[model samples]
Target: MSRALKATAIRLTSASALAVTVLTAVGAAPASASTLTDGISATARAENGNGACAHGGYVGGPNQSSSCYGGTTTAHAWCADFAGWVWARNGVTGLSTLDDRAASFMDYGKKYGTISNTPHVGDAVVYNYNGSDYADHVALVTAVSGGTVTITGGNQGARPGHVSTNATSSYSVGSLPWGQRISGYVSPAGSNTPSLPNPASLPAGTLVKSPNGPDVKVIINGAGIPVAASDVTPDKYDLSKIVLVDDTAFRALPSAPASGTVVHDQAGGANRYVVIDGTALLIGAEDWTAAGYNDRADMGVPTAWLQNAAQRQLTTGIVVMDQTGKDPKRYVMVDGAALYISGSEWTADEYNTQTLMGVPGEWLKAAAKKVPSTGTVLMDQSGTDPSRYVMLNGAAVHISAAEWTANGYDKRSLMGVPGGWLASTVSAQVSNGTIVKDASGANATVYVMAGGVAVPLSYADFTGFGYDKRPLEGAPGEWLVSAAAKAAPADGTMLLSPDSNTVWQVVGGKKKAMTADQFGEGKLSFNDVVGVPTAFTAKFPTV
Candidate 1:
């Protein structure tokens, strides 16, 4: 027997007992009795045994093998499958294009030109669709009573993954279960689509209200976000654009405002928030000007809206601190993380010159502290420590006074950092590519650094290699003694014989002759060739 006939037989055998149960579940009996010709609504009702079907499992439940599962070997999220099966059984065209994903119904509706915001009996309701992906859920609309939409879907029980009727899972017309909003409704192909207000048709920032309620909302991104009457100011919102809409039309719009909107509580509070990805993050008073939020108009929102919005750390690069003065430490926000900056360092880096945003003490305390970005020059300002350092690959490397002066680092601004962080740095040799000679040693030999080793340069080679044009840093006598072992010029160094036009490219400690053609192909320029005495060029073997 067909499933619909079986449902009828069951009802006929126990009509008295089932009638009371159905009435209690539905609050009132449906407008019409169940029949095979009733379309998808009848098929949906029969499959769930009129809200009596339950197996107590999310997957592999007794309903897994039911018609709602679409005969799959393993149970999956079956809400879409159930809706699709009901529509197909009721002779809806374009069922072949439907899939097990809730979003597929939306695609089918759009392809068949049957998708709209209005709900109708036998239409499929899609929830939480963000465009180009599977929606959260789907259900068959069994009834569209005033202010309420009754739907029958699978995997929707308290335990989930079970077939059920609208009697167990009905919702207000505009909202869905679990805080989800209806993305759209999809009617069967060739069916007469219902007419409804399109929120997208309204211009953003227009003030609107429902005739049934005095509460007003501002339209933003196709959604009506409630704004407190007292909070609406003529300076930010135009009073003439406020329009009254029917309750149903008003409810059809989504409730959340778009990101970057500035909002404050309508009930009158000093607290303000900025919407980001649908959540409101608190913006302290000091941050309003520093973060440039003054540029955005402030909207008064319902108190409930602020209460429901979850707070997260602000993702910005602004400088922030505690306004209470209890914690005088200031921090720079780097990708949502905070890096504490000392007072001296703050002034030296000119952060003191910029506007500082003061946030709540509790929020500043909760922020995660991270290291400063690389390339920052830091010096320990404490009278006990005199070491200066530079940030490299996340760690601080010590820079000697001689090297600092030789490199003209005295001209660069120094950030005063905590002595504790400075103690973590290692007193290592100067970085590669630096020209160095002993600061106090009698040896006047100058060397160019290459991978921590020093390669000696003659007076002629120094000027020829263009090293004379660059800053020659001074190194400690101890470091120079260890690093100044006799070695050839660094690999890739182009050498020119002092008395001849011969040019050689250094490779693996050997010199390779370069032809005119080879030099042009390699993009070698005569300016880069270092002129060395015949004895220096003759030391390395020719390759």
Candidate 2:
């Protein structure tokens, strides 16, 4: 609906969010990113229409020059070429050697460590729809809708090879079954802007001097951020917009940013100051901040606690967002039915304190114990501890731990299963083991192991599914047959009786009874069923 609502609902993905942020920035490119464009002026290039690239023209056989960008030829896929030309025309630096292949943008971004999922307004959207590690197409990120990124590209639709605004591709930001057709994003090549964020995102009582012509002023306050309250009037900017915090005792207001200048605070960490365009009053609570949580209004709606916080904070440990209550609490996330605890932040001292918070740590350990002791053991290569090793469409990738809490983080992608479902192998402790049948011969008892732990099957299910059962007065402990243990057992398995004389072996993938004559005295001592060996000839001495 509204632009502010849309922005608040979702965030722009990082074309380069992994790089550690600088304390002070005037919107300059990160150390890990090269400039692609400083944003286009459209000079004579209209936003859309037949004359999209009017001022630019083509000459020789469509080289990396400005001609190929808006050239009259559609000989090759020039999405990347047009993007490069746009960046070059806008006076961005460091892209003189940009290639025509759509994947080269990724190479440039990786070289500078800026290739990320977050897309800016002028980045190249790389795609891998064909399953290639290399991107198949490239487009420009022109807008972000909710959690979807919309971008424009070349060689698409009827206007082959023109800079068009409507040419778009979408990638999901904060959703499950997460991710877009997008491979990643590449920033523009150069131009060292001071890395300043929009001055409007600062807290109340922050004094800001508007940019005087093109001159910008950057000042780091004590908090390391360029935050201040103003009561100053100069050649430019209205000081009235600055929040006033007058002590009143001295009858004076706070000082203003020097020279009415737009400032970049060096105190704030990289990516520490994201623009929150929401209407709710969320404080920067430490736990919520670490978990990348949105603040709750002092007594605001509780469900509003961690909207879109699933991915980023999910990296390090188990992050359980107890969305069950009105105000959802946070907990460590775990696999196996998505176990979640209900609470806020925890520190190193409170580590392993699930019991303290009324969580059954023992229960989680049960599942974790079954998984590979270390995720590395499950990985093709384990260089270090990663955020999570995702198995997507059967392809496993190790996401970096450094970005455990970055935006667009989806766990099911890493888990390789749909939400609310877990990957598990239900195995009976004992297979092809001894079983006691009823006197009426209508039912059988299935023991879990050698020690006779009865197979714990749901009775309604045990009888409803037609496992061996009888019309007894009470449920029998002598489980002769398994109901749940062999729902869809693999071919060639064994089913035997506790008597040790009656033997049944799977033949040609079907269970067949062994002749009693075959297991008398010196006959075959063992019979194989479903890949398990059962001692049928040896008399099972009954107590």
Candidate 3:
């Protein structure tokens, strides 16, 4: 019977940190890995023409090294050393030689398991080809094919100590002369040896169960993952069982991540799909870029369109790309599923106006009834006027008497700003800090609390990911960056910075844009910033 052996190899090394990747195989007993060492020693012994020395023990010579093929009257071939190790593992004390090891395998008693469809654990995986007339490199079988014989190994590299998903064809086998002759196989003993565990089990051919996770998520590759509820497995469908999007009741699902979508390519091709609120938006393979998507500019029509459609269908937040200098704007598939136009220069107003709130204030008022209203309204500018503002508890706040707030304002707070204003915005019952941008990507702020009291932040030292110490300087009306937020340190010192991008944090000698994740070792991207361009320079007077 034709068998499919999905074996993996792993090489080990002692010099540097090892790169570790895991592979899982089901069923199938593995072949003995030590056989490779045995084969190496036996080959050396045969080449040296050492007679009884071929018994496979530590037969050393003039300048010997410790290996299964011990005699190093010549330069040591690390490959031979590996072969010797296998022999040593086999309990052959003195007959240490590659030739001896191979010869020993030829002997009746010590040979390992035989190779076949029913391969068991600890069998030597061998292959025959080329003029070499014998098996060369070897690895222990960890998993078998069909409930039995199969192949796989890792850690096979030039150093032989490296681990990999499969045997190294060049170094493992090709390193020796005549390394490619199939001479059957052998299994090793003693491994009640604990093996690595496989990852979560997946029933074969199962896909798209139900909604459960991120509101809109997608998976392009499912190699290591099991079939989950939030996926669409068109690739695995049989002709009779195929279901089209129109035929399914996907729209009836809630807009939760659990109802997210998964797309697969079964036309022996790669395609893209977007997951938006449980449904998929397929861009197909064409017209994606023609419709202004430059990310897949060069992809074939079918592939590109499939990806574009996915992006369009996403209901997730947008990710604006910077496309100032490039001919065409590019798109990034955020959350690994939805593609958004990327590389485009953005601004506070641009970012704000892009949201649903950016619609006309009249439109907002018309839809105001749709959103839920909390009874206790905290007015931020309450001190201004009871008719205009109302202080809920501590922070002075502003609330609109009308069902909806004015243009460019949210129903209960500022229109574009959600989570409320940083300072005047109440936290539980108290107000302590101001709103600010946390990073280059998004604007988020936090309020400072001390001794259980909301301590108002000031303009001295604000701590965050990136830092720009440049003071706010420019024509006032020209729009210097706004003060993002103010925070009073535990020491009573006030911290401050413009609301746009920079937050004061020190790295190496200079204070520049820095993120907490990066261990203050590298330079920030802004170091390359030339002066603001003449066109936009007026708008960013304080930058």
Candidate 4:
């Protein structure tokens, strides 16, 4: 409840005679029981709606001058008079002048230990007059800074009806009325003990800032400095509910969370981020304060805004991706990390590579798939059909000599490992003795599947490519090579001719030589896609 209401309740509870008797008996009471807050509240209410205490017309001072104290005359100093009226309203009796009453009240507080001279919030700051007989100046301290009181007073001199900070002047008492000299302090009633907030009870990393409508800046642990009202989450926080996303790119206080701390996606309009640590996450923000800076948090006017906010560019660990991928584009990053680029702007290399440039559907499917513990695999470049030379783990699946191009390899449909396994048709002769090799005639493994099971390709299973005639050797489920069969092209028998380097052979009876465009668009057989924590095991060998 407000101080005025508390004082009113106190007055109502005691009988009029009893109150007078108590005051009379204890003419000099301690400042401990004094109500300085009550006095200030009463003064604010009186000055708010009525001209009785004309606030000195927005001159930036707390109260009006004495010249305008008596309901508009602007002659008498208004600070003491306002205090006098407040004192009277609080039922303080026998007070003719505000000046004398204020001093007497302070004197009574000092004599009885009811008040102190130190200034605090809601304290009546008494200023002494240099040449006057009595204490002539007073104001209500709304806030205190560096132990100096910012007062709301009136009727001292110029700017007579305004509120100002550290108002000390010639009219001030006990000392020269300068910015920070205090004559004496009057203890306001019920102010000695305040309900302090218990920090230990609050959650660690709790947002401890202003809890009211007016903007408030908070300093946490004397290190994490203030955050503005507009920047901070606009809400009141009690001791019970406070822990929230801290020092992350997306700034927010969550009512309920998935983790002890989960980041916000307010900027990207999507809830996804690469959490650097529990204390920080890389999220897209339209207005990020830490943009292009190391020390994100600071104590000063805020001037930061985010642009190009998105979640696809983030990783879970260290940031390594550059905005531009000129030559060295591919980045090996952790599943979750903050990725930064050299330029102010950058995009994923997968989105711009020449081999995978126009594959939007492939890109989406790859990204949307679950995270893979192992690396990614894409189809080789020379193969006409993506399913022809598939990528099992991170190596090429040697199907047949024709399945691979003469000079270039094929890897078009290689993005996501859906379901953990892939399948493709191979010529039966490939199971016989026939091997594919690099441009330098170096033998390369050719993977082949029989009985719907995958196997590694090795020279022991099939003869090296360009060999004339070989016989079949292994069973359908086992890795084996046979002797040379009829050396004729059949269904799905890919043949990479030594003549034209850039051509694919995919036909029933006749072979067709297709261009690069025709080669990349071929069909793919995605067997399965797997997320993390899944295993990939196979037991066949292809040579």
Candidate 5:
């Protein structure tokens, strides 16, 4: 209803006060004797046509009056304000603890022990409550019939800033919009609470289902784990403990269940699997007891879900070995592959401090014997040789100690490989954009790798182009001496002389001076400019 029409109705009601008084004098119940629910309903209905609820823009507008905003001209999100006003007018206590935020109503209910899952007349329904401290909206539940609830709320229209009318909406029980759900229902302080289970207080391992779907999930470590319907049995799981929640609250939980949970196929299959680091690993029937998993419950899940989860490999940094002691080798997972961990390296990297998960011998056999992922730092721990190398381009490149510290390689986790892998000749060169200098020579020159050749960088260029801030890795002196040398920057490289304002774009082996307008027209940024020595820029002819 529009506020203009409501004003006319108010005027007509005022003119009929005498007639109403005469009728009440006979047998009608007076307004003062109305119940709390009736009072809340009447107050909310009377506010429908008051004015458009405004957040801030409607300072002096009809909605931003003293009645709701404490006489201040500034308007705020007033849905809570309107609700609080109606509650306080009806003499509901705890208005002092209430605020303008919708979440405060949930807090109020908890403090008063009046929060529940079932809705009742005069209850405040909170939407999008994530169990901690967030809720999107709140409204007064004016009616609760079979499978449906009717609510009236202020600031309820589509337009946020200038919503004009208090609105009423009806939703079938547990059927709120996506990403929004009734988190809880808060009744008035002294009302008799319903006997439904409160999801917030439910313990871990409790089963829960969303009203939107038929799937049931068990709560593990605050995450939802899907359980097949066939797996839900009377002896295994208590069906009566399943709490019904909305989709938003269900999805807000962690997607994957906790690690170390055992599971099997829904149809009572013989194959069993254990979840570790979000991946499911098959546990052989013979090895299950040896792996210390004989007592764990093997929960049944959908077959397709188990297969999809098995596709993910165990996460890196987990240490694992065979439980039967057949291989007697410990390996650390990296990029879905296992790299054998030498005894010395294991102690140095503190792998001994981590828990070692035991798997079947076949799983260990399949994961072993693969090269460590590229960029892994490796060292030969079998002998006294102190050489350290970096795996790049499928080969090891020798890196000196000075380079290791300068490039922050010392901070990376070092994996020990067999001495045979490090004895092979260096086949990979330093990649482009890497800064290198010969550490064996006195006052060695700093160079940047370009086109597989080392190009000397002047001190001014090194600092001006911001290359000094990058890690300077040391290459073998013999390798740098034999490598080709480049006199000019690579073609298509953008260069800027340290002393000049002109920006040069290298094209077709020539330097082309770019104007300010041309640089802007080409959508080029000065941040891409590489400061280089004037002598290097002079090698390219101006075109």
Candidate 6:
């Protein structure tokens, strides 16, 4: 229920009494019982239409700095502005000072070390996307009951309603739900006990310089100095989530923690990373001189340096296979592990001439079979796909390879036996296989798909372009059924794949790909042709 602000008489209390109440509520003192709680509710000016938003204009309209607490330059989707105003009025120092975007609460929580999973009245709950810096939405906790909490937030409805309590959806405080979208709640001032250890107190390998100065540009390599330079760590924190036809990169972060003062257990190893100076450094490697202090080499940011709780859950125990070469003898890695082929096991002469019965898919399955244990064979990629393969050790694992996981590859310690298995979910992945035909053979502009995602095969590269590409040998179920066999959809009607997960539409008698998320976008609109189209069977290339 939401409403516009209505003036009402409030009971008057002494200044000292008001101060005591706020402090008591924040501290939840010993005198206050926790078990038999009265429960907390909104204490801010969160009443609907209560703030200046009633008088404020729309987004891109004139800025009413005086009325809107200078939260936004101009009136635009003022959910955050309204929230900021309420917090500021309640003397929430951080919200009042940095009230601009709805996501500003995330930064506020990080800076003051006031973020919590446990719900409390007057706390700000934030929702972030992917690993982004900004939050998508925020609400004020109005009440708490068991696992759920009631929230009062602006822009709760489709029309950007005023502050009201909405309970259609709730988030978890005990554990992560899917992408770890909810960034957690921010406690009001004085109710927090934060422990931010000094650099020397943090784990070794933590990159520390000063409180607010230039990064020493040194890297901590656990207890030992693995050469002061970035010979070991990957560089650039920006990772691409989807790659499109034109080779454009598309990345999205649904929820990421506030980008400051965090600790990550690097891949479950002994090495720990603490965010010092807004940069991630390993613990125990805090010795400045050990980093080649005087002539320290640049240890730039690593890709997605800090893994939040959700990321850690997704990455832990997930295995990916990295294959390079004509046959199994060369190199094959399953979750960073490789079958060691010592010495010149295969000289240039012996390697190229070895007689192999099948394609890379067959070889991959064969190699995986050699492993004692492997996960179900749900996905595979051929040798000639245009996208770069394994930029580093098992790079595909870094990218969100949905199809790989969909193909019975999740929750496994090792790659399963070389055969296909049934999957509960089947997401899309743009196949990097070669097009039916190419001039330079550099790569096919388009690729083909059979059981798994499309890829250019070594044999097909010289055979009949992409037209002759056949379904994989051991593919199970209708996933391997030819796309040509499927009936075209009605002109305007978008159709989900035979798997009931993929979505596409036939326009002017041609196939046009679109985002699968649209299935939950309420209804189809004029811009039904919303996203770019490609032929990954169930998936489209991300740009």
Candidate whose lDDT is highest: 5
Candidate models: Cα lDDT each: 0.59, 0.35, 0.28, 0.32, 0.60, 0.35
Q: Write the per-residue lDDT of candidate 1 for residues 1-543, one digit (tens) a residue.
A: 112211211110111211110001112112231222144665566566422233322222112223323333324555665676565544456666676667777677667666665667777777656465456677777776677666777656543245666532434334445455567777776422223244446777677864334567777656787775544562255667777654456766778876667787766778877775566767776667666677877877666657777444444446777656668788765434456776666766566775676555555665634444444566764535777666543445556777676655566667665454456543433344567776544568987664345667888778876779977755555556666563655677777766678888888889898888755546877666655557767888998
Instruction: List runs of model 5 lying over 4 Å from the truth.
Output: 1-207, 210-216, 219-223, 227-242, 245-259, 267-270, 284-296, 374-394, 397-543
lDDT of 3 at 471: 24
Expressed as tens digits, the lDDT of each residue in 1-543 for candidate 3 is 001111111111212432221112223333343433333223322233222122343333222343323432212222223333333433433332133122232221132222232234444444331112222234333443343332332213343122223322222221221233333344433322222112112222322221111122111222122222223334333333322211012223222222223343333355443333433434333423432333521211122224344344333244322222222332222222212222222232243245321111221222222221222233212222233333322332333344223222233342122222323233322222322222222222222322112222233333342223332211111010222222212222112234444333322222334344543348333332222112221222231
Supply candidate 2's per-residue lDDT for 408: 26
Q: Model 4, range 1-543, lDDT digits (tens) per residue?
A: 111211111010112222100111223332332234534443444453333245432111122124353455444334555554444434343333233223444453444444443555555655432212334346565544563445554443343343233432232233334442345555444322333344333433344532211222232222222334444443233334433211211112221221112233322334322222222233334223223222222212111111121223333322233222222332222232111222212232232232211111222233333232222233322233445333322232433545345423444224322111222212212321122222223423343332222333344333333232332222211122221122223344333323335333434444454445543335421121111100111111111
Candidate 6 lDDT over residue span 1-543, tens digit each: 322211111111112211100011122321121211111233332255443345452221122133233553324445555555555433344344354465556556656666665667667766542222445556676666676666776655434345567542455542233222455676654321122223323343444332111223212322111122332234321112111110000011112322222344332444433332233433343322232322323222233344322133111112222222224343323332323222243332132233221212232343444322112222222212222111111112111244334433344333321111111112322122212222123333333332222332344232433234432222212222332233433355443333334445656545565664555557664233212122222343212
Model 3 misplacement above 4 A: 1-118, 129-134, 142-182, 189-431, 437-543
lDDT of 1 at 317: 45
Can you rank all candidates by TM-score, best first? Answer: 5, 4, 1, 2, 6, 3
Regions of candidate 1 where Cα sits further than 4 Å from its true position = 1-194, 201-218, 221-256, 314-543
* lDDT, model 3: 0.28
Q: Which TM-score value belongs to model 6? A: 0.25
What lDDT tens digits, residue by residue, belong to model 2 across residues 227-251? 2222122222244554322112111
**At residue 498, what lDDT does model 1 achieve?**
62
- Checking candidate 5 for backbone clashes, the offending pairs are 52-164, 66-71
Better of 2 and 4 by lDDT: 2
